[model samples]
Target: MSEPALTKRGRPGYDQRAILEVAVAAFNEFGYDATSMGVLATRLGLSKSAIYHHFSSKEELLEQALDEALDGLEGVLLEQSAQVGPVIDRLAAVLRGAVEVLTSRLPYVTLLLRVRGNTDVERAALARRRAFDRSVSALVVEARDEGSLRGDIDPRIVTRLLFGMVNSIVEWYRPEGPEDAGQLASDVLAVALDGLRVSTRSTGLDRLDHR
Candidate 1:
């Protein structure tokens, strides 16, 4: 397959990254299987050859777009915040980072979340996502072992519950919406790490007596 090469001028500043971002949005709007190269070219206001200059095929575009999504999520694990803290703190940092990545790259992450793994690219992306989950679950195990997280809950289940809440943001979150990424991240950590109900363990069940 021919790699993306810049030759003829397409839309202004229509480089590979730009094209891939637009393609991600398109794929999110119209499912990847339904989006044709011609439709993608139309979305970019460019000819088919122009898109071909960037991506060899629709599948190639899908691969790159999914890569963008996976890269954003995976990069968070390597951040200093995720690595240097106590296990629960590290988990909080990872969750916050994941939320920021999801909201900032809404279209790409949305496309990533929707993949059903029918294609090789989808399968690869799914693999990377599961690997990320395992890494985070490791933190949960550490936190549980050290008595930070609740010992009654399985570490793997805790990891899934926390991540499930984070991942669900892609369903309704919008970059242009009222809540920004950081605020949403804070709220997620607050509710996930802390109970939604009044802390009966801390204040006693008498706090519930008022309700």
Candidate 2:
């Protein structure tokens, strides 16, 4: 038999996982709406038909990509590390897990973050993201009720602030850059949960005398 045909990129076979990875990166670099099947194929050195063979459409590819990112995050909630600890510690553990997932799957997470819910897949992804936020917020509420976390701030606001700080990592994090995931996770937990106080003692309104 003749040698197997090669794609324009001169490859004999395509790896589905690798293809999805390239697609995710392209979706991040160029807006998903602006990136087309043909453009993705060209970027991957494959024919449009080759890509079609694996993904029915760009929407399917996007769904798969976001799924990878969302799954990693959702998986964190199920970890024993996050499930059995004190409420405050559980919340901190989850935050660290989120950082690890984001750092490990940077492109997919980055793409998931940028999606604007313009399509059904994107909207579904957004719903899942909101669910995650609510779950984390529940932890904050529990910690406040347990008196381990400050109760003055609304739990929802605490969740927003904590994730707002963690999520901001997507904007500047580089897998090849100086920081590693372990260190980043520690630093994030330190700043978000521990704060900058010289001591962990109460310093805000809780410290004031009501008299």
Q: State candidate 1's TM-score.
A: 0.88
- In order, candidate lDDTs are 0.86, 0.88
lDDT of 1 by residue, 36-152 (tens): 999988987789998898799999999988888899999999999999978889889999999999998888888888888998889999999999999998988888887888888
Worst 10-residue lDDT window, candidate 2: 1-10
The list of candidate 1 runs beyond 4 A from truth reads: 1-13, 200-211
Residue-wise lDDT of candidate 2 within 6-107, one digit each (tens)?
556676856777788888888898889889999999987778988888899999999999999999999999999889969888988899999999999999
Residue pairs with colliding backbones in model 1 are: none
Per-model TM against the reference: 0.88, 0.89
lDDT of 1: 0.86
Q: Which candidate comes out best when scored by lDDT?
A: 2
